[model samples]
Target: MSTTVWIILAGALVTYLTRIGGDLVLSRFERIHPRVEAALNAVPAAVLTTLVAPVATTGGVAEAASLVVAGVMYLRGGGLMTGFVAGAVVLVALRNLVG
Candidate 1:
């Protein structure tokens, strides 16, 4: 196999292993509490925030504005896709204006 093929296989194996590990751990607990469920649901957004925060902080005005718009839209109960679109539009407009 080529290097790319080998890398892809390794990544797939790692992903599968992680999923199995999580399932194994969760299998011990038949039912998680409502609060735990809520926290679990928030994990994706929390991770996304962590990923974006550093870039937004270090980036120019447009990046910061985009982050603010995305966050506001999300907090206002907009769907994830809507929040992404709103942030992207703001970022594009700001970049065109300032860049």
Candidate 2:
């Protein structure tokens, strides 16, 4: 309906296509090169950094604190889901209290 909606839909479509394309291409290969496998393994962390770094840089204290909490949680072996939930709780609590 709106430009933002169209952009979101387009992004979703592209993301889906890229995921399926990657799977298809990898399936055709009998064995992946060690370098290629290492690069693929690094993709998730790279993507996460790209997504978080911009927001953490430009956001307010609440956002920054949430990111710090999440990072610490992960570093302390809290696991992904626990880190995410902890960050989300901090974000919501700070936003509500500060605002």
Predicted model with the maximum lDDT: 2
Q: Give the Cα lDDT of each candidate.
A: 0.91, 0.93
Superposed Cα deviation of residue 17, candidate 1 (Å): 1.3
Q: What lDDT tens digits, residue by residue, belong to model 1 across residues 1-99?
A: 899999999999999998799668877998998998898899898988798778777989999899899989988999999999999999999999999
How many backbone clashes are present in model 1? Answer: 0
lDDT score, candidate 1, position 76: 96
lDDT (tens digit, per residue) of candidate 2 on 1-99 = 999999999999999999799898899999999999999999999998898789789989889999999989989998999999999999999999996
TM-score per model over all chains: 0.70, 0.69
Please state the error at residue 24 of candidate 2 in Å: 2.1
Candidate 2 wrong stretches, greater than 4 Å: 1-15
